[model samples]
Target: MTLRIRRRRFGQIAIATAATTALSGFAQRAFAQRGGPILYGVTLDSTGENLIIQALNLATGNILPINIQRRIEPGERISAFTAISGRFAIATGPRMALPGRRLGRRSRIISSTTEEIPEPQGLDNDAAFESLLNTNDNNLLSIISLNQGTPPFRFANVDRRSGRVNFLSDVDLLPNRRYSNLCQSPRGTTYGTSLGPDTGPVLVQFDFANRSIITGKARILPIAPLSYNKNLLVNDVADLALSPSNQLFALADPTYEGTNSLFIVNTQTGEMTFLRKFAVQKITFTR
Candidate 1:
């Protein structure tokens, strides 16, 4: 079967089986007893024309579609996604736009009232917001840019209530090391994935409050390379998320071949466990 067919079949089987179990009343009770936070993932529909948000039950592995007020267009790409103050904050840009061109790339907080985050000054017109996390204050959101000035990466906080941007310190100048995505736990500990030219992917813990890397140089992920028709290597992480209970999860993508998969990452031991085949681009846990 083709990749699209496999993905459609997977979605169908997951939803149908979950629905059946829910009707039987076992899955719902199990989920409630566990009291785990619902993990949300964003994926394309079967037609690949629109994005669909689904709520995933970690305990039962059941997926249910979620309805949002704002409809994401087909050509728009979600660069960053997260939840704060019981609402969804999404950073998106048009995929068809040319490089160095601004095509209305911005961040939006969706709730009873939709708010747009203003683009900060001194950044290139093409700079895109790549990561978002909630701060201690409900109205302030921590964000990072894909491209900034000299060092190329900047960390800042956005005030959702007043539409103000407060520039924080720039990311540390680590030679040959770059961060791809960022996520924070409910207790305010932030983590990121660091990539380098000579080393494999490492999970770097950060104390964003002080704008420093806590783990000087984290160990490489314990994921082995998959050998298929050719050797397929997992080289990059597309997204990272932390559950309410502080479990680190990653959407790992192969460098050249193979499909994206979700993994449960152990922060202390640098170990990873394959969770499921996730073809989605973004995943976040509901608050």
Candidate 2:
């Protein structure tokens, strides 16, 4: 199955342009956070026939390229770009083949493409989606899984150093679940919620027993979307995410019923509040 989502870069950076005083609060926190490198990566859009990613000091257009580079995947399109501390990442969606045309559904390969610094965050067929890059003691990649080709969504993890993945649980985390989202906090911890299958955003967490092993555990944390119904396009929620504040924020698809809007949820206290909604176009975010 081909993965679906958006990719963007540096996100509409607000502070870099703000005056020295006005920028102190947000900028100090964002740029001065307690972490390692301040680098970020994203699959850049060259506008037409040209796209590349490079590091900048918010000054010169120097564009210091990261070692790994690849034109947007042939059939795979990049939709979102983000960076953690300094590691850059890109979200990718599949370019499905038409009926009886191209590879078609019989391709038998997962197309969701996620790229991360050090290497690709996701694989050509890992079928990865609804992902986020975590930057702290160890860079962690969080994402929802479509590996089963089923309705409910599943959770997966990647080793920041090796770019390898492990199931959240022995029995696919959030098994038979759907319409889910994931987010990491300022504490070097990751949080997630089960979207569809008629359940709240259960909190699935990652734990490292030793430097070499990773284990996922969950606590059915509660979250309300302020407006969730049976009609939400389950597949799309699988591409959902939240702000650093635990507020719910997801890509909105109008084809969906009940005025599907993106909002913020207070994960610390299972509360849902509407953020905004999209009309017809798709919402893409980049670090």
Candidate 3:
């Protein structure tokens, strides 16, 4: 229902102030809006789970607040609601009691999953649409919305690609309950998550067609034994996700100074590998 996510500081920005923060330890350009039809979205909550969605014309810098009408019902928080072609779908987190705290008030908070936006004029055809949704629990959820320009949900086909680090196909691996955050996998077939109270990256695979996970689960391959010869932080996986290049990275909070860490992973050996990390406050892809 209503779960508190990690907290981050936010700065005020008038329609003209392009929100910009240090990312990947690099000074990413501030949100740019000096061109034509704008293209960009900002979560109402600067950091943490963006509760409110704001659409901005990156080109014109005009911002449109997303007014979602769905309530607390099953699959309320729709994922893939914005797909490319057709056959679309969305999901929901567990519901909470309405303000009245009435009985049986448990329901998802999002529906009409499809949030259709006008395509940027002259946009490339190959560009795929992607969105993330919070699982009822601390889990990762993503959908590939296709040809979002048409009717019926305004999406073509939507499916659950990841459930944490594990792919939805790996449904058998992840625990149905308990966890903090879930992230996308480089391959798009799986997703990873922060360890539960027990502390272990849960990597699972998916079967988007069936809206289910497959295979078993595996702990993120630990830092390479040789990597131990260097340095590695333990105990705080703040956030998890994959970059546009399809590399696995984690936003970890070590017990020492500056726990927020980002890095890619390599599991090509059929095992997880903790690659190097970045020092950015936060990182997002442009796909």
Candidate 4:
């Protein structure tokens, strides 16, 4: 099926021109050699009721939409999703009643009865839970208990089989730390999107398995032209992913007033390469 992503804006075209002149070398080095077949599962909410799940072959840039499933409420978008080994997938939203599901082999929604998971105790009234990433096992889900009144954030795990959420530990970040999205690596290294000071959104890795913070340094992303000269500061990232080649990929959420752009960042030096500008709902890569 054809890709059903949001249309590219003219402002993005201008940014593309500038990116060619400014970031040509970086792009060349990043995409010079293609890796093995990289599969990407993407979720789009353009038509709300029919949440679309598609697979993109990153090596060939081919898109094959698996199916459309009616899962969430009319206005709620899928906040997080994880693709399991057996073609099973689980999704969650901020206002979803049944916040999880198991997808069939062809990405069809399998009929299952699941109830909303209860909030973990000990969280103050001001703190709210947000769905994050799934562990390498896929049975355990990682969540962020964001305390609006405090600095340290609480982490937890949710059992998909029983729909029980258990508190894990607290992550103490810098005072200006703000995460927009979460992604996990095969080695259990969890990456998050952090809005950097004066710069664009960046990636921060937390070794959740080892119960330690790996890195919170700002790996700034590129900004779309529409927001370059305006009062808009930096683009916000909605998703952070680790590519098959150990490279990092980030998706910009247009909800922050900036146009959408997909970025490829080097994991070692923290350099970013502008890939493309499109409104992508969700992105996860597989080798």
Candidate 2 lDDT, 141-181, residue by residue in tens: 44444542344444455555565555455324445665334
lDDT of 4 by residue, 1-287 (tens): 11111043322111122211212132223334643444344455555555444444455454444443335544344555554432323444333224374221111111112223333334443343333454555544444434432234445555554544566434444555455456666555566655545666555555433332445322223223222223332655556677645566766644454555566755644445666654556666532
The TM-score leader among the candidates is 1
lDDT of 3 by residue, 99-179 (tens): 664323111112223433222222123212233433323333443222221111111122233211212332232232223
* Clashes (candidate 3): 52
Best by lDDT: 1
Cα error, residue 38 of model 3, in Å, equals 15
What are the runs in model 2 whose C-alpha is more than 4 Å off?
1-71, 77-82, 101-126, 144-154, 160-162, 168-171, 187-190, 197-217, 225-262, 266-287
Counting only residues 3 or more apart in sequence or on different chains, how many pairs clash (N, Cα, C under 3 Å) in candidate 4? 0
Cα error, candidate 3, residue 119 (Å): 24
Residue 215, model 4, lDDT: 51
- Write down the worst ten-residue block by lDDT for model 2: 104-113
Ranking by TM-score: 1, 4, 2, 3
**Clash totals for all candidate models:** 0, 32, 52, 0
The TM-score that candidate 1 achieves is 0.68
> What is the alpha-carbon RMSD of candidate 1 to the true structure?
9.3
User: TM-scores across all candidates?
Assistant: 0.68, 0.49, 0.36, 0.59
lDDT of 1 by residue, 191-261 (tens): 76666666656666664344225544322232332222243334657788888788988887643336676
